[model samples]
Target: MLGLVGVDVDGTLVGTDNRVREDVWAAIERGRAAGMHFAICTGRPAVGNALEYARRLDPDGWHVFQNGASIVHARTGESLSAAFPEEALPGLLNMAHERGWLLELYTDTDMAVTQPGDVARRHADLLGIPYRPQPPEALEGTVVRVQWVVPREDEGTVTATPHPGLDLHPAGSPVMRDVMFISVTRAGVNKGSALGRIAQRYGFGMDRVMMVGDGENDVTALRAVGHPVAMGNADAPAREAARYQVGHVDQGGLIGAVDLALGL
Candidate 1:
């Protein structure tokens, strides 16, 4: 039996419209009634709309945000775990500037980009939050993670470069197929590590956990759980990483995945 369930936002939980279907919410409520906990694990920042989704799903539950760079309580806003490696910021910023890449730096309070672009504007619009056009040095302090949104064609080149203290993972966005995400975090930070922490806190092992996702960044968390589910619309890498595959997000895949997890 599964004790905890972790779900990715964006493509996995909600569709391009960013709305969670009624049936999916119903399934989550059913899972909660059966004593199962749910966590909103995403590569999104911990602040803004991400927290709103987390509270809506499980107000008292843990939230794994920024691709596991931050783990916090949804309702109380207490930090269970957080990582902000300032040392990696300089190198990441330098690379972004040198490569002329549009980079967004995320803090607990705000998200800023060195220069605004279509991707940054879309992100801000999606979160319904305002972003500042600040240089990397100006947006120092309390940086949780950095992301570079590049054209899909440039993904290979951007990811090929290496930074000393940063770990890079390239992921695709369901809303923007032409774009690719280069997520940069502290060397050891990833969703898998954060899921392990959540399991430890609740006294459950990976074998008792179920996770659902549909993107490249979600691969680590999917592999960390016993019941790994990939949405039918997921990228090839994500589908290959999962133990089971369900319908697309538009077809209520989250609902199906949860039902399968609970053996309902």
Candidate 2:
């Protein structure tokens, strides 16, 4: 039996247009009702994007965030595990500053960013999210995940323009494929590590876990989980690794998968 089920938020749970379809939400509730466990396994930060899911959907389960850099229990706000060494930040942030990328910082308890602009606002709006802007001083806590935003036309800049000393990556949201951004972290921190932690903590085999994603960052999860589902809108690698190509998020792709998983 699939003991735990992992979901990708942007394209799998929410739609390419950033709308969270009612059917997908219903499917999640149905899976929970059926006694299948759920987790948000995405390239989003441990406490950044995934925290919202923890607060709303996975209140009963743990979340694997930052591509598996960290895991936390949503209700108690207790961290089950954390990845990333302190030494990795200078190089990580340096790459962002040099690349002119919008860097978003996250930790187990807090999240902040140095800047917010028109495009960023549009992204938040598209995702149906509201954010109160803050200044650079807001980065007061340790950062678990760091992200960089680049224009789609400037893709080569992030890939080659950043300081070679640091590690960085382009973060793709299958639903938001037109917009461009990149996320960077220590070498070993990613969803695979997060899944390893969860598998150890729960004493479950890889066969018990399943992941769904639709972005470049989700490559780790799509490769690591027992079942990796790619939304129709996914980036190249995510689509390639996904064992199944469900419909688009707007069309209840996730709902369909759940029905099939439960044989409903």
Candidate 3:
């Protein structure tokens, strides 16, 4: 029997605009009723501000947040947090200031984002999370990860911040713009590790789980599960990782993937 299900938020399950449809929620409810353990394995940080639908997507299952930097029970909020190496924080901070790009820092309980622009404010309003404008010094005390939100059409120009020991890479859901988000975390802190840990903790075999997504950060989770599905709108990397590629989210790709996974 399929014991667990791991689905990404942006592309595979929801549409490209970051909203969850009623039909998809029905699918989640049905999956739960079918004795399948459900989890939202996303790069979104628990400490940072989230979207409105995000709150609804959560509160029902395990949250693989911060791109797998933290794993927590959504209802109880009990979690295991892994932070970046202390020795590397200084360089990361310096790089952020040099680039003048907004940096979002994530801890299990605390969050701070610098250079709050209009886009950030809009996102904050949608999620109803109060944005506390804090400086770099606020980043002290065991930061699990950092993220960069680049402006539209400027993703490619955002040069990589050299962190030999830290892992820095781009992240987002199917709904997000292409290549606009960059996530930074410790090498071992990611969705793949989180998925593996969640499966082992719940006594589910790796082969019984499904990981579906359409972004680069999702590559880890996609490779970890028995079936990795790429949305029809998935970028090249996501398509490469997935064993099966479904139609676009707006076209009811997730419903199709569910049927296909179970041979329904």
Please identify model 3 stretches exceeding 4 Å from their true place: 47-60, 126-128, 139-141, 152-159, 172-179
lDDT tens digits, residues 1-264, model 2?
A: 566777777777766565677767788788878877778776565444456765666685778766555687777766754534666666656665675666666665555665677766765554344665555346666666666666787777667755333345566665466667666666666776677677666778777777777777787767887777787767798889888877777788888677655652
For residue 230, model 1's alpha carbon misses the true position, in angstroms, by 0.7
With candidate 3 superimposed using the best TM-score fit, by how many Å does residue 113's alpha carbon deviate from the native?
A: 2.0
Q: Model 3 clash pairs?
A: 10-174, 11-174, 16-175, 43-67
As for candidate 2, its clashing pairs are 67-190, 67-191, 68-191
lDDT of 3 by residue, 123-154 (tens): 45433467666665766566888877777566
Q: Write the per-residue lDDT of candidate 1 for residues 85-169, one digit (tens) a residue.
A: 7767777777777988888887765667876767777877666577556666676557777888889999988888776777786
Which model scores highest in lDDT? 1
List all candidate RMSDs to the true structure: 1.7, 3.1, 2.8
Model 2 TM-score (2 dp): 0.84
Q: Of 2 and 3, which scores higher on lDDT? A: 3
Candidate 2 CA-lDDT value: 0.67
The true-versus-predicted C-alpha distance at residue 61 of model 2, in Å, is 0.9
**Sort by TM-score, top down from the best:** 1, 3, 2
| Model 1 misplaced stretches (Cα beyond 4 Å) | none
